[model samples]
Target chain A: MAVYTEISDEDLDGLLAQYDIGQALSCKGIAEGVENSNYLLHTETNFYILTLYEKRVSKEDLPFFLGLMQHLASSGFMSPKPIRAKNGEFLQEVANRPAAIIEFLDGRSVKRASPQHCGLVGSALAQLHTAGSDFKLSRKNTLSIESWRPLFDGCKSGNPVELTSQLLSEIEGELQYLEANWPSDLPSGVIHADLFPDNIFFLNDAVSGVIDYYFACNDFFAFDLAICLNAWCFETDGSFNITKARKLLNGYRSIRPFSKEELSFLPLLCRGASIRFFLTRLYDWLNQVDGALVKPKDPFEYLKKSQFHRLVETVSAYGLD
Target chain B: MAVYTEISDEDLDGLLAQYDIGQALSCKGIAEGVENSNYLLHTETNFYILTLYEKRVSKEDLPFFLGLMQHLASSGFMSPKPIRAKNGEFLQEVANRPAAIIEFLDGRSVKRASPQHCGLVGSALAQLHTAGSDFKLSRKNTLSIESWRPLFDGCKSGNPVELTSQLLSEIEGELQYLEANWPSDLPSGVIHADLFPDNIFFLNDAVSGVIDYYFACNDFFAFDLAICLNAWCFETDGSFNITKARKLLNGYRSIRPFSKEELSFLPLLCRGASIRFFLTRLYDWLNQVDGALVKPKDPFEYLKKSQFHRLVETVSAYGLD
Candidate 1:
């Protein structure tokens, strides 16, 4: 939950002047998206999300995010379209930060994902991958397999007292194993790298919208599924619900059939995905910004997920047979 | 900025079942209102504010707050009416907290108040006072003059490190003076005790809405003006703007003319208002909730305002004849 920048009325007026939408009726800071300030901007015509990109999101990569949204939305995907300004740019500046007005899709993100919700999420994510296949812009996943070791090192150096020595050594061993076994060349495309349940909105038992494209990047589509497995299939008690995993995978495969190589590499990719989140969460936990509106998510949840995936021998364990 | 309660989908569904406002389309937690969890709820029919009262707001006072909004809005004041449920009740339960859905008013709170904006705010506030005059419910101001000494004691007990000995003594002296000289009689009615700039919204150069009735209660109307004087007339650098104050007073009197006694007591009321905020702010600053999203406002801002009000000899200092 965050609104890092306060957009003054002058800034808002200047921004609205660049758009043909309408005059600003109300602009409220919304408690969503930690990487940027988000406002639920109501205008004379319609409601739109006004986002001011903070320091965490690179201004250079904004076009890729905004462009990706435009591309997917135009291609009939569930992504909300980024509204181009009168200057024909999706990106603009507000309160000294990169900003944009985005179409407001009407759907509430589910607090708890049922098997049905997971199925819809899986299909929506696959649709996103298919819709984004021909997008001209591309960005490499910054928190992918290669960045794990350095992130782990940074977390270790930060000296988080909560991380036990045994836990640290276990993470190091897992990182080493993942570094050696992580798969490459497995049906790469645009992946919603962080497709947690919170990022997928559900209405009337269907995925109504997908949002928060800050982490969207070019990566293995199977790795995106792996991320979903870790995010959606896990219960609060740290047990994997294979039924949900089956529903998610089956839902995805029904849309875009997975290759044999992709299925074989699924377990390893899941482990890598867990390691990626575990390391980043650990880093954020160890080096939490003072007065940050968002509480750093617990790193151990991903650690347990990594441990679970480490024991899986084949796609059969994920009920993907 | 706060969203303390996380309402689950089931809770939201249960809430909507009690209302006829159409099925829930979306509900996004908004970074507005420090004392409650506020969501910008979009239903199939229209946009509304869904607020879940936090512990800071007394449960018994829920009816008064909601009812006062109903009274004001129905009487054609700028206040947003609380949406009643199918049973004709203005309040309901969500996530084990008292909650209500309020009609969404369209306007943006000013970031910086111009003198013209001040004039609008003044007239709107007077209109609120006039409209709320006949409301059956009455709540005594809990944070008024009598509560200042106890709040000051709490702050002193907390031993805020930033407060110097001299500052403490000055506050104590001011408290003594206010207690001795606080007026017993002036025109009294339901007052929106917390009329900060953010609590008022404007559109097309007029006040479109006045909100956050949690602090509304029976009090001297001139004291409400005094609160606005401290809130809207002070510049960021702590200088009082007499031009803005004059406009505000004149604008308010144009709506409901002030009595001579009310005018004579304005300076002392301003000091008391300052003390009221100073003690509460100091108490909050010294005892901030751990991991609170909203930062405690600097207590010293009110101290400076209190000091400024202390030296004012008459209403002329406020740019009045």
Candidate 2:
């Protein structure tokens, strides 16, 4: 749980004076995560999560996040809507941090996300991409494949420079190969870039809501699918779960059938997803300075995870050929 | 990195002063965690972690945890020692919660833990258990097989409940059978119950430090070995990794050879390990009453994980017999 701001009863009450949903609220710190701060809020009628902007979250992107929620909500997306303030604004200040609130979704994420649920999630994801196709704001996917080099550069360890350099070189080569061959002009829109197992909420065996929109941005929908592949489809030991993979893709294609181009790019997108997490882990590891209360996670775990993904790419390459 | 207490910069500096680590320290909140309020404290001397006790951690058990660290450090174990204050007391109060400062470990975990490193870790772990033979404390393995009944009771629910229940019933039968047959008293000592890949640290390709002592407790050392079978030796798809498993076991046996009784009890320990994590995930799923900052992990993932462990137990049972 990443909760960054505390919304006092008075503050929440003051803000709720305008919402149609009715009544003031009180909130407590939920958790502060690497990407966002969340507070759990209780109101007269319902529970909600109040998120404060973190460093990784840009304020300029606030509209995209809040607007996306409201848009989806208006479209009967079955997702939480961002509550507006008395001033008809989605953003507010809490704990000296910029914040917004969303209705708490009922239900929990599946432990083993079933093939049926995977299909449902895939269908819902396609719906999101299609619905968001014409969103007014255009923010590039911050965690995309092209972003890999900068992320790799963050691992500026003077020693073992060869390892870091080699990783970057490998990543750069993949970028060039993808850029030259990956399909462009495929239907594109805002995609949930980090649809890990922990993020999606399910109710009655159906995906009720997709939360955590901090990583949602303009990108090829397939890349989002790739992220989910790395996150949800893979097993603990990093195996490519072909059965689950097929269910996911089948479910997704039912709503938005893949173009030949998009299908061609899927393998590369999967490789990109693996590399992204790997680089982020490496960056966090290299930056572990002293006096931190929480231990920095091992970058090598993701590095090893990437190796598994690479094996998948090698195998899939042959399949495609 | 869950640190559960409200803490400040001054609090961190004061604790570091006791350690005489001559480091200027800053504390940052870790945003996403279920169990504790974690902070990354950076000091002038070196990076270290400060954890504020959250509700799940019992206050009375602090001594066992702190003492275990001290015991290991005193016995020349290459792990962090909880820094003591000017009063030479390891425990301190932070944000009205029990707090301790621990040395931050550097370097990444070996991506694919090599057989040699696995062997080294196995020997180090055996040595750790041997060293803790006389420590004056006792606590139940909070998530052991014995705890599964209560957890299953907690998780009983709607349509899917029957399937989960059937699994639990089978597990329960296994538990009863194990209890009737397995030896309990065989070279008992303190052991790291969750010695997974993420817990240990490597520096320059050597075991820099063993960490995440939150799950450490007094248990039959052989049980710890059984746990490693499921954790370190298993392949990606819950498959038995015979070669890696043999390497790990042989390495540990070389340091502290198991008694025949201990060898016979290994299968039960493996089953116990499966139930332990399964119950934990189940408990976590049931207990998520909303307002959590972190995403409640899928309890179902462990369903598959535990299934594999059960398989390993069956395999080990035959081999030992």
Candidate 3:
């Protein structure tokens, strides 16, 4: 729900001239992506997406995001491939911001993802891991283990415990425990750290496309699965649905089997993922700037989720053997 | 810039069940309309805009707005026609808000509108007035001369003169003048009162569509022209460009010739139009709600335009006679 940068018509004309897509017919700011300004661009020939990277996105990490999409597309994945310019650069400058044209993928993100949708997303996630294996670039997961404390410290001055009675100390305890027990050896790969339902498009009851790779980074492949478990398997009432979890994990396993060690690390990784989202959402909730277009998501949901994950001692709790 | 309502997939599926547009493929909230939550809905057959009317829009006036669009579309105008439900009603309920699916018009609004764009808009506006001549339903312009005082009073307590040196007294005097001298008879009809650049779309340099008819009402057709004069003729530096105004007036005259009375009232209508926008913008500026998505427009811009219009004594001042 953000379109921070407005690309002018002359700028768009100049941008379209660099590509073979026919003359620009329309470019509308899409109220979808929160991290970057996205436009649904229509040309004489086809519909494409023109994304302008905003302040929150790291400019240095864009090559990894773009390259990951290009690599996935080359591997016959249903992701938006960056359209190269006349100079063969996938990234170009528009309105002084890093902008690129992406092939438009048809389908809509499910609001309440069904078990079948979760299954498709899981299999797609596994496929993405396989496709991303041959990619050369890598970006460290900045929001992983080491960054949680600083993020929590940034918002601790506001006394975030007001959101929940045990919020402050609960987060502190989890931070200490995760820092001490963070996994060192696992099958690490490019992971979509934020593969929420909003980023996964389902058409005709199948995963049509995987979009929004801004949060893609180098992390344990199982960590990515753990993130999806937190994202897709929970019902709106703060309860875990075993059917969804089992279906998702089964779908992922059918494509790329998880190792015994990976399965063992799943509970800790899921707990970490929960706190990772909770801390960020809490920070944003506590310190939302005036007149921001996006409504800050409720951090308390993640708080409840993290609390639930704290009770899970084994993968069996998530409907996994 | 606004999508105040979020329509869930279940709700959307229920809504689409009453339509013959085929299964819903995608619905992305569009960052276009400010008054309503607009989603670009892609079905198996065609594309449409799912607009959920927000609070600012009066629910009672939905029929008039939808009827006006239906009338204009049937009259061969390039406007979004409201898609009727299987129950034969254009307006339906979605997420507890009055919602409708409008056939998506294919064009883009110009950012920096050229004089040629102004000319096309003027001609299109005249054509709209002609097409809307027999629209059965009628709505009063809620922001007309009678409403400016109340709107001004809403912001008067803030000592709004601090925004510009003579803002308070100027608005006060202009309010009295406009109220006392509003025209009694000058070719009144259904007028698109807010035909700003963003509301008019161009394709291949021709006016492809006119939209955002929320401000459409039964008013002096010349008043509508005056609104366009204020909207299209001003440069970013706050100077009124007579060339653009002349081209606009010429385009309008080419379609429907103005009466002498209409011509004589152009300056005052233009002045009244300036203040009408000034008072509303002033109200919004002085009383912006927290967490609102759209930024308040500068009220002083309209104040400057009103001051410029105050000096004009005859139609020739606007490159007309």
Candidate 4:
């Protein structure tokens, strides 16, 4: 629920002049995508999403993000293509912020993921990886295993009363284990690091669209699956649903078969993924911006997910043969 | 920026079952209407606004509000018509709150109003009043002159540090004068009690839609005009633009001619309208909810507006003959 920057009528008209999508009929601030201010833009021709990149997103990385969408979209992936301006550029400036007009895709993100939904999500994730394999631009995963310790130290420096001594020790132990055992020889490509349920839309029992590419970067393909395992395979009571996990992994392997090394490193990567989210969530929870519209997600949930992954020994624990 | 209630997929499907508007394709929470949760609902058929009435809006008043919109839209006003369910009910319950599906109206609300926009707004407001005159429902303006004193008392009880002693005394004196002098007899009808710039939309130099009718109620026709005078005629620098006010009044009179008595009482009603807004804003400012998404508006701005209206002696001061 964010609309950090309010665009004026003149500025909006100025933006529309750059595109040939007809005159603007309406542009409403949509309560989606916390990292950027998104407006559900309606033009005389059709609907599009007008996004103003907020401070959280680096302007230099926008080319990679927008370019990746264009690449995936042209490759027959479910990503919504960014509408190019008359100058043939996908990015432009609006209200002193980099803005883009994106094609509006029709699909609703599920609040609760069923096993079938998990299957579709898995297939879609693998497809995204396959489609972006040939993309030219590359960005390093800034929140992978290496950043976890620094993020944890930053979290600890805040003196968060919520971080009990026992919890702190648990996080430290998990960080050390993940850093030592993390696999480096797995197949790597562009991975949607934040492919949470809310970021994937479904229609007619299939994944209709995958969005919020701000977190997309070069990382181990199996690590992306690890993130999904933490995000989609867990129930409200903090119990892991192996059925959903199986469906997700099976669905992915069907699209792009996982390597032997990828299969072996699954549990450790899941642990790494959990800590990555946990630390980021913890950092946000501690350093929340004043009057931020988005509520910081509970970090303990990720910690519980991490604990679950710590108990897993092999791929079979995830319902894989 | 509000999405107080999140509708689950199952719940959304259930709600859609009652309506013949086809299956829900997407429902994104829209950052509009502070009092209610609004979703820009896209179905297989078309787009609509699905609003869940929050606690701020009284449940009992839903019929009057929805019915007024139906009446106005049917009478060819720009108000968005509420879509009735197959059961012939315009309202239903979703997420345990009263909900309604409304036809999506196209047009962007202006951040900065031009004199032409002000004129269009005036004509639209008069049209709304005329169209709603025969509607068989009446809702008392809850924040009218009768409620101002109580509202002011509530604000004072909070002991707001921002309400200086001088400002408090000035408000008290204004309240006393308004209560004593508020006219008892004027041409009355349904009024859009809150016709701020954000509530009106324009396209191609014409008013395309009028929305957020939650504040509509039975009140003096001239008092509604007074509200507009305060809202649309003010520049950002706190200076009143008389040319805009003139255009607004002239545009309004072109639709439904104002009575001499209504015109004579305009300045005093403007002062009363200012106090009404000032008190409510002050009340909200003092008793802000924790983690509220919408920021409470500055009450002193209305106080300044009230002071401007206080010195006016006649309707001619409003650029009227």
Top of the candidates by lDDT:
4
Best by DockQ: 4
What tens-digit string does per-residue lDDT give for candidate 2 at B129-195?
Answer: 8777767786767765556667666666542334455776776776576567656467777888888
* TM-score of candidate 3 versus the correct structure, residues matched by position: 0.95
lDDT of 2 by residue, A1-321 (tens): 444444444455565655555553333444434467665544566656667786767889988888987887787776688888767899887656777878766544555666676777778778788777767877788777667767766665453434646766776676566557656566688887877765776655677777777788988888888787666666666555666777777778788888777776676677777778877777766665444333465666555655665555432432222
Candidate 2 ranges beyond 4 A from true positions: A1-321, B1-6, B10-23, B30-34, B157-165, B297-321
Error of 4 at A81 (Å): 0.8
What candidate 4 gets wrong by more than 4 Å, as runs, is A158-163, B158-163
Worst 10 residues of 4 chain B by lDDT: B155-164
Residue-wise C-alpha lDDT for candidate 1, range B45-138, written one tens digit per residue: 8999999999999999999999999999889998998998999999999888999999999999998999999998889889999999999999
Q: What is candidate 2's TM-score against the reference?
A: 0.49
Clashes of 4: 0
**How far is A57's C-alpha from truth in model 2 (Å)?**
8.7
TM-score of 4: 0.98
DockQ of each: 0.91, 0.04, 0.76, 0.92
Chain B TM-score, model 2, reads 0.85
Which digits, one per residue and each the tens of the lDDT, describe model 4 over residues A1-321? 688899998999999999999999999999889899999999999999999999999999999999999999999999999999999999999999999999999999999899999999999999999999999999999888888888888888755466789988998888788777888788999999999988999998888999999999999999999999889999999999999999999999999999889999999999888889889998998998788788899998998998898889899999999
**What value does the lDDT take at residue A145 in candidate 1?**
80
- lDDT for A279 in candidate 1 is 87
Please report how far candidate 3 places residue B163 from its true position, in Å.
Answer: 9.2
